[model samples]
Target: MEDPIFSPPLHRQRHQFVIDFIKRNKPQKVLDLGCSECTLLKQLRFHREMELLVGLDIDGATLKKKMHGLAPMSTDYLQPSDDQLRIELYQGSVTQRDARLRGFDLVTSIELIEHLTLADVERFSEVVFGYMAPVAVIVSTPNFEFNILFPGKTGFRHYDHKFEWSRAEFKSWALKVCLDYGYEVEFTGVGEPPPGQQESVGFCSQIGVFHRLGGRAVCNMMFCDDAEDEFSYTLLYSKNYPSLHDNNILQRVLVTEVLSGAEKLRRKWAEETNGERDAADTQAEGDWEERHRASEQHLEMEEKQTDVFLLVEIPSSEVEISVNQMDCKTLQQAEQQRGFWRSIRKLRKKICFGLMAEDNRSLGKCVSVPLAVLWSGCPKVRALGGSLSNLRQLLMDHPGVTLSQDGSAVLLNDQEHEEEYDDLEDSGYAEARQCSHSVEPEEDWDANV
Candidate 1:
């Protein structure tokens, strides 16, 4: 994979250099110039922090063929997510000024300038630095000084290279570009130097990283009227992944996580209760009142069963404290499962969205999750300026979910009821539903596993 003279493949080293730069800077928008085969773009797509990614190249045929690799895979559809990473590809030369290419946070030209003729090289300098005016620019070229290390090589390293600048020549061009374009540059490169020539020569591929001067770092989106001429570049591919900011996508992702988590909690509580009734299963198919009373019976049975854990002679007040303590420990142990949320924390940590979700059959159909679990794993709801009230409203709107009378838990898979759930007339029924809502009331919602 590497050149005969290079130990670490030249292309791989260049890509790693760019990826590492991105990790440190965390740019939101990135544009790659001369993205042949788009291998870097493919790798960059995994970075969710980059909301907008665009790749440009003169090779239209190749760009069109390889860009589809950037599309969301099947698992992305199944297990919804909050991060909205959008990727686009265009067929155009880097020298041409496309309105869309301007204002990128990071612009990269890896081993590209050497392919252009001397005249086009000057145009590239003007277009990328003076016109596109990206906040930062990274340009790497073959180090002409390192060419002496290759035994049979002479003249330019590659057949297509119009010219390969030595370390001094590359620095001269980069410094001039910065001086004219209001940028400051730092020179660095990847790939090791020759065996005994560390100080004598630079890396096999020399790189120039330029940043815009203080106030010049902004992307002037309104740079000129030419920017409105959107046809300057042909868009080869475009895809916007699901984002929490988007209402429909957010609701689906949040509700799915909540419903699944709640179902697990209820099922787990039932199994450990040792023949205690399942509230959701025994819920009467008739009016809400019957379902409320049936749920009460289950709670009474659970309380009585757990009482066996305490001595028969305890006072009533002490007995209440003892039951509460036991219930808290039981729920704490159940929620300590493996990292579904670790990957799902979009605004919190960030979910890497490629794994298939568990099958619906295994999760079962008639699943209901308590509101506490739903509100805890609510999927960056607060990041979107939302509260529990807003989340409940979204779940209220979900087709498969039904909010119980007291707004305590969401019932799932039940047939749609036309009857208004506004407020019930019966006080006893409301209290029963409210009691069921407190299933794990004392557990901290903010602290998740």
Candidate 2:
């Protein structure tokens, strides 16, 4: 399907529900089944970390036609002119594509099965279930009751649809398939009838989630109904976390701890058992401790494997900032700090920190003045992050500060020069004057102030 300004009702509502599901549980891979023309695929903008999107359709020609219309994946010489929608669009019927479909974390069959023949339906169940990674599968089909209102209008059915069921009939069939196939079915999109429609035409859609014995749980479902009547429906299916205790990292951790503790108890029991053992079980006790110790150690390592840490780095600068504290002469760290603050003087974001002086003698002394203010009339801070002309404008804003001829130092309020920062120049026998460390506290140094 071409990217339409407005998505059909069923597809649009279904997309909203899927977006919400992704927000809560971000899956790494998504399989779109019977993805005709992939209209919704165009609108999806995943976070940079997302990987593995597969769009499957029964017709290779249709798939290529649609993908080419959108734009192909780009290489160095041939760039796609459209948005970088590098989806993996596979050509082949889902029933025939089992060899290509095995690892997806989510399999979404949206309003798809109704079009399949009964044989195709069974093949779909077997193939889709087999392809999933011991996880989950989502199946959605139109509600037959919904089809009643549009009788003979043929909405859910393409001229190709073989069968469509009403709400109860569909749910009954879902309940049977789930029970027989070990899937847990959930009904959705059913609600009060739209104001003036028949039960079949106005009734909402439904979805089901199937968990294979050894696969990850399925998490997405899309159901799209009629577009012309404005009564279409869409539904998304998201599974709650599954319980595979053997697969849970934390559970494995705790199990290892318990087994290690059990091994120790086993050793104590073995010693007791040995006192009464005959030759028959003597060899078992002889090697049991070593074996248990090794197993326990293995579990301990497994427990350690459960710990996860994530590190992310971005551009930032770290610098110390201080503020004068006159009331208490003792130097103290400020209790609060701003993560980001804008410096209008520099026209850039500045990382800020505040410290309260603790020494009574240093009370009322200016804490290290903010670089923004200290270099206010000078262009030093501003020029570092922007052009010289912009820096001159910034200097013009602050009246008293000035820069020396070489522009390496800043004169704060004309009292101190940037060269004053060079401690190495005065190292050889120059007695540094001790500025008065003693000063009275200013009245308003409290954090609230």
Candidate 3:
């Protein structure tokens, strides 16, 4: 079922031409003119620059059967995206004028123009070049000039092809379309000619790249659903992919980033202050001292200056961003910092020395986290296996924490601090627990300390 002359198959080569075109011109909104089984649309979905990807085919049933592959993947939740993308499949003819198909950044028709009759081909030219007038258009069809290179091929390459055009004939029609529609055209082809046949034949498949002049195509058809009678396209599938712009995703990014940062900071602070003490604790020093000195006797008599740190865990509920809590510029920077897909590696620390630092500061024994900063932009708050909100509410319901009178901040009485944080004695928290060997996402703060 494959031709040796083309080497890599003409259809695949055709698709590659369009894919390269997309890479060169990162069009926000793109429409596939004759999307048969949506093979090209499936490949185009991976491009993050593609904001709106629409596939149009006359066969609704075939499209419905094939579009399942275009749905969001399960792995998307493990990793969230900031790119705004929407994919849609609609059943329609390129010959007919559909208001929804107007003003696209690019329009593509691969090996499809040959499938239409001579009359429909004229209509296709008018609808695509004159009516739907995208910024750029790519059309590929069989090059009749290359037929001589085929061994046993007699008629057109495919039975569905109405009339295959020679290189000259194809160029004549493309140049006429540009002249009639105020656009410029460039001719190119894929599937290199076999050895020693380059002079006679051009290529297995020919392509035309059309660019519209006079700036961008302006259309008033976005909301023009008034004439329902003329609309030929039937909506098949539509989905708004989860993006970082969403409050839920934003909260997740913020929560994960802050938690991860806080954990690293706490680890560094602990390592610097109690690196030797941590080794002692791991060597049964804590348990040994507890048994030997009866716990409080040794801590109060010799090791007393070191105090336990405080980390106020936020709620699990998706944070609704507020101006007081964080600004848009901060959120953008946070998103840019990760530069990775999904929360593969996060801090997720439930106990840190005051998680956020903004206008709020630690007062005395109580370390305060601004309620605003706590619910910072796109902060997805989770702790260990359990939720941060559940444990936070649990602590609040109990005598574990206290709130400021104005409710602007959450003052955690759990964190017992001295007048100064720097030059503090060996960390009591590190001395008691040692290094974070048992760092779990769902561990409760009360039990952790």
On lDDT, the leading prediction is 1
Off by over 4 Å in 3: 1-3, 217-230, 276-449
Count of clashes, each model: 3, 31, 15
Which tens-of-lDDT digit does each residue in 267-307 have in candidate 1? 56546652442332233223333533554455556753543
TM-score for each model? 0.67, 0.41, 0.63
Best by TM-score: 1
Model 3, 152-193: lDDT tens digits are 879888888899999899999999998998788998889878
Better of 1 and 3 by TM-score: 1
TM-score of 2: 0.41
Q: Rank the candidates by lDDT, best first.
A: 1, 3, 2
- Score candidate 2 by lDDT: 0.44
Instruction: For candidate 2, write residues 1-449 as lDDT tens digits.
Output: 11232245565666655555545656567778888877655544333123555677766666666665433223411321212223566656766534445556567787788889988987777666633332556666766565444435555546777887766777776677666655666666533345776433544456666555433423122112232222111222121122122223223332333233333444454466445644423443345335435644554455433321111111242221222221211111111112111111111111111112244223322212222332343342332324444433443344343444444333322111212222222431122111111232232222211
- Of 1 and 3, the candidate ranking higher by lDDT: 1
Cα displacement (angstroms), candidate 3, residue 296, comes to 19
